[model samples]
Target: MDLKDRKRTTRQRLFRSFCCAWAGLTLVVRHEQNMKFHLLAAAAAVICGFVFSIPLFHWMILVVIIGGMLALEVMNTAVERVVDMITEDYHPAAEKAKDIAAAAVLVYSAAAVVIGILIFYEPVMSRLFS
Candidate 1:
C-alpha cells in the first residue's frame, strides 16, 4: 500500500483521528482490568454527586480527577505494551519500565480514592448518622 492514498480533507482527517482515539479507548476498556475498575469508580462517584446534590464546582473537580486518572491509566498501558514489545526477556530495564508504569496507575488510583472520600464522606455521614 502506498503512503500517498487519496488526500483527506481537514474534517475527514479530524474525524479519522477521533475514530482512532475512540478505538484505543475501546481496546483499553476491553483488555485492561484496571481501567474497568477506574470506570466503575467514576460511575459511583457520579452517582454520589447526584445523590448528594454536590455543587457544580465539586462536579468539575471530580471530572478533572477522573480525566487525569483515566489518562494516566491509558498512558501506563501504552508504556507497558511498548516496553514488552521492545524486549520479552528478563531485562532489568524492562522490569523497571513496567513497574514504574504500574506505580503511576497506583498513585492516581490512590489519589482518586482520597478525593472521592473527601467529596462524599460528609454527605454520606450526615445521611447515615444524622
Candidate 2:
C-alpha cells in the first residue's frame, strides 16, 4: 500500500480499537457490581465538585483520581477474566494473581478517599460552620 493508504488503514484500526475498548467499558459498567458502585461514587464526587465550585487545580486532581479509579477497575476485571480463562479449577497461582490485582484497586481506592477528604474537608466544614 502507498503511504496515504497505510495512514488511512492505521486510522481505521485505531478507531476500531477504541470502539472495542468502549464496548468493554460498557460491559463492565453494565455488569460489574464494583464498577456500578464506582460509577455512583464518581457521579457523587462530580456533583460535590460542582456544588462546592472547586478550583481548577482541584478539578484537575478529581479528574485524575476518577479516571485512575475507573481504569484500575477495568484492569482488575481484565486480570480476573484472564486468570479464569487460563484455568477452570482453582489454583493457588490464579488466586494470588486475582488477590494482588484486587489489592491494587483497594490500595488506590484508599488513597483516593484520603485525597478526596483532604480536598473537600475545608470547603465542607466552612460551609457547615458558616
TM-score of each: 0.91, 0.93
**Model 1, span 19-91: residue lDDT tens:** 8789999999999999998999889899889999988888998999999999999999999899989988899
TM-score of 2: 0.93
Lowest summed lDDT window (length 10), candidate 1: 1-10
Number of the predicted model whose lDDT against the real structure is largest: 2
Q: Which runs in model 2 stand beyond 4 Å of their true positions?
A: 1-8
Write the residue-wise lDDT of candidate 2 on 1-130 in tens digits.
3355455667786777788789999989988999999989999999999998899999999999999999999999999999999998999999999999999999999999999999899999999999
User: How far in Å is the alpha carbon of 101 misplaced in model 2?
Assistant: 0.2
Native-to-model Cα distance after best TM-score fit, residue 79 in candidate 1, in Å? 0.4
The superposed Cα distance between candidate 2 and the true structure at residue 46, in angstroms, equals 0.5
Among all candidates shown, the one with the greatest TM-score = 2
